[model samples]
Target: MTNMLLAVVVGLTAGAALRPAVVALAIPAGRPADCPACSPRPAGPTVLRLLSSGCENCRGQLLDAPWWLPPAATAAAFAAVAAGDATGWYAAAQYWIAFLGTALLLVDSAVQRLPDALTAPAAVGTLVLLAGAAAEGEPGSLPRAVAVAVAAGVLFTAFALGSMGLGDAKLAVSLGALLGWRSWQAAWAGLVLAFTLGALFAVFLLLVQRRSRKSTLALGPALIIGTLAVLATGP
Candidate 1:
């Protein structure tokens, strides 16, 4: 319990403290894009403000983010593995996997899109990280993670090929981390939740003018939400 609390504290503090830096990084340092999310009274404060705060690219939209969210997710993964059949290192890996998903979803949603720059590296990095984790710990889990990565990666890749952007497949790598070698329940639930949300988002577009009749919904956010939901439900 104490460790969980500490994790929560660290996650919250890091998220909040990092916000200014993130926003600062978003902007080009000199120009302002007139975003609706900003304070109108400021009348175009330096782009530095938004970039440092992670606000320029919709980073500010994460205002309601639970500070300890990542830590809590990590704790849950840890608990599941310790009490259930999963190994400790595998559980640790999933904690990060869940974090990456959740983080990407919010960031992409706020920006109204996901950049391939982010997704491409993430997909590759996740594979490398998982491979390393498997190598360092249990050997069998590596193969299982690989299978999960291929299955999930291909599924999302096919979806992107059919109707979405390529980033969707890259985002699937995150799900692979959570669902790999886990019970079938985790895999199915996460996948179901992601697509269900994606479909619902499409309907939402029709109801509101936020999106066009033909504009495709971003899959990064959907996958992120789905992964988080699965993580919360535990194995």
Candidate 2:
């Protein structure tokens, strides 16, 4: 079990590191959008090329860099499910969360300016799983999963309302549901770490004059990365 956990953690880290490539492939520089970096009236192809290959100006603004993300996320989630005791059931849950969560994160952050879709569902899923804990029995019935999930949700909702362009309240539902009440503590801790890192990133961008005080950063990917990192950290 220890060895398996370690392996899963490594895989999660690797997958997260590769998500940018996957996102790029899926969106595939499909359409060109305004980039803050380019000169005024930059050509369509020129901007797309910069985004596809990763323009210096746009850098972290878009997740185009780690297109490997989707596949990598799948790998990490499945690995955790496989390595855990209830292989069939857990693997299924992990697969759905990873796939849906990753896509939702991208779409919402890019299109809606809100990354709540994925996280909210995950938190809800955790609660649903808990309600059925009796039916599932033993392993899945571990106490406090629902509580943890809810708590994490509440905590994030507070943060979301405080500094973002969107409501993060919904995100907690999914994150809580997926993580379960018992495991949510770990989720929050992971969030803290991810946010800290994310803050630093924002600071770095600001320091280099890439981002302005009003420039927003996508929170979904950071949450996803944080959640996975937390899960990876667990015993």
Clash numbers, per candidate: 11, 34
What lDDT does the true structure give each of the candidates?
0.57, 0.53
lDDT at 65 for candidate 1? 48
Best by lDDT: 1
User: What's model 2's TM-score?
Assistant: 0.57
lDDT of 2 by residue, 188-207 (tens): 57568767877876898799
Q: Residue-wise lDDT of candidate 1 within 153-200, one digit each (tens)?
A: 788777776777666777776567556656556777778898899889
> How well does candidate 1 match the true structure in TM-score terms?
0.65
Best by TM-score: 1
